[model samples]
Target: MKVDPDFLDTLRLGGEFNARQCINCGTCTALCPLGMEIMPRKLFRYALLGNKEAVLKSTEPIYSCLLCKMCEANCPGGVHIAENVRALRSYLNAEVLEV
Candidate 1:
């Protein structure tokens, strides 16, 4: 699928999540009990590559996030996972729902 170059730009311009800061660490996925099949790392990777389809298709995982910050605590890269999830959720609301 073609990548949307403006996907990450839109996310960044929104100034909510910092997907660019992720270091591909698996800590976030591992810490999530509700995310066994879905991982934040994968989501962030999609966002970084401008894969809007992948991001959109991952609705179940995105909204499933508890925003518990367990991943944030375990993140060695210091990625703001909670904030990023919030931003992603907001993006989904605005883009998918056209809110």
Candidate 2:
């Protein structure tokens, strides 16, 4: 799929989030209460690489997050997991969903 080089920056416009801080250590995925492996780390990777299609395909998992911040507490990279998810949702709503 083609990449949208500015996708991450566009997503950031929706809200404040430090997704770039992610270390991809899978800590957030493991700590997920919902057992959703696609939750954060994967999504963040897609966002970082400007893989808009990948991010869009993960819409369900994005909204599924409970935003409990449990994963954030254990993140070695100090990524604001919940906040990033929120930003993704906002991006989808405004840019994709046009809501």
Candidates in order, TM-scores: namely 0.89, 0.94
User: Residue 66 in model 1: shift from native, Å?
Assistant: 0.4
Model 2: residues with Cα > 4 Å off, grouped in runs: none
Candidate 2 per-residue lDDT over residues 23-61, each given as its tens digit:
789988888989988878988898899999999999899
| 41-60 per-residue lDDT for model 1 (tens digits) | 99899888999999999988
Shift in Å, residue 18, candidate 2:
2.2
Question: Candidate 2, clashing residue pairs?
Answer: none
Worst 10 residues of 1 by lDDT: 12-21
Compared with the true structure, model 1 gives a TM-score of 0.89
Best by TM-score: 2
